[model samples]
Target: MRQEFDEEFEQFVRRWSPALLRVAFLLTSDRGEAEDLLQTALLKTSRHWSRLADRDAAYAYVRRILVTTHTSWRRRRRVHEVLLDQLPEHQAGQPREVEAGRALRALEELPPRMRAVVVLRCYEGLTEAETAEALGCSVGSVKSQASRGLARVRVLLDQSHADTAIPEGAR
Candidate 1:
């Protein structure tokens, strides 16, 4: 039974990993973190592989796991933040990456649930109903979250551009 489950899990990973990784990347906004998120989701999913009703069910289940895991990780970090001596920072990306980077940073600033809702709806092209199902919430909640998330993202992007712009007198 374990061998059978392993084979099924491997096949599922091979088939769905690319799409899952793309979703994870949107959720994480970093290549390394995205890969790690997907791996963690897959690892969790594999434990219940034999019990999953079907491939689509497994995919949806794993997506939920990924979102919840990310939220948990964020909460853990917040809890330990004051105790930590320092956090490592990475070097800046290329000039061409600036706009994308700003958008991602803005997304990162959103609350975890809002970020997940935005990624599922906008990035994944899921309908409100579909998103509600994925997030295990009502359609109304999905609508509200998506609206607020998009609004926050717009404000963040505008602020980012404003910060980078030179004043007319200084130009």
Candidate 2:
């Protein structure tokens, strides 16, 4: 039985690795950090595989690790960091990339939990209940985080609009 479960777990990890990496990328906005975060999450998940009651909950469990891991990483960086500009280059004729960059900046400004909630709910298209499960938080908290995250993003975008002179009707 244990061996069977192990095989199943391996298969699950293989199948979900791409999706998990994508989720991690959305959370961190850095490819290297995303890969590291996903690896750490998967390692932790593997350690607890046998104890996990519902196999289907593996994704949520791994995601929770990602959220917490990212939060810790960000917290540590806050204590010792200087300002730096590392924005990605936008392609010509790709207005969407510019908008995405603005949104990404807003996401980076959000608190870690709020960022995870927003990414899971909006980017990953997870339902509130699923997000709550993945975040290991109450649905109410997820709702609040989602609301606040979206509000903050909007504020950031609005500020960008005011700061830039891209014409009134361009966007």
Candidate 3:
């Protein structure tokens, strides 16, 4: 039984790590912090792996740990923040990369909860109910947070677009 659990746990970790890391990165807005968050969550998940009956529920448990952990971290470092402008460009294609990079920058500006809501909904493609479950919040909260987060993102994107627009006089 232990061996079977170990195998399944290993498989689950491999399958979910990338997605988990992406969510953690968005929540923490720092590569090092994201790695730490993932490590801490995985460690917590491993300790409880044997008790998890439905193996599928492991992701939900891990996500709960992530939200709780992030909340605690936020309280500790309440004011320390990094602006997205400081992030270096490492995009692939010149045009698409630039566009996506701007989008990412805009995402980085949202508050942690709002950012998590957006990442789960937009990036992970989770529905409102699923996102609410993952975040341990009401579906209405997910809807509201997503709507507000998206509005902020659109404003930022619009500002960026306006900045790059060629003046009519110049054209």
Model 1 TM-score? Answer: 0.82
Q: How do the predictions measure up, each by TM-score?
A: 0.82, 0.80, 0.81
- For candidate 2, give the lDDT of residue 29: 82
What lDDT tens digits, residue by residue, belong to model 2 across residues 3-48?
A: 9978988898898899889889888888888999999998888888
**Local accuracy by lDDT, each model:** 0.86, 0.86, 0.85
lDDT of 2: 0.86
Output candidate 1 Cα RMSD: 3.7
Superposed model 1: Cα runs more than 4 Å off: 1-3, 79-96, 169-171
Clashing pairs in 3: none
Residue pairs with backbone overlap in model 1: none
Q: Native-vs-model 3 lDDT?
A: 0.85
Please list all clashing residue pairs in model 2, or write none if there are none: none
Using TM-score as the yardstick, the better of models 1 and 3 is: 1
Q: Is candidate 1 or candidate 3 better by lDDT?
A: 1
Per-residue lDDT of model 3, residues 1-171, tens digit only:
889878988999999998788878877767899999999999999998887888767777787788778878887886875677576857455878678767888987888788889988998788999999888899999999999999999999999889978899999
For this target, which candidate reaches the highest lDDT against the unseen true structure?
Answer: 2
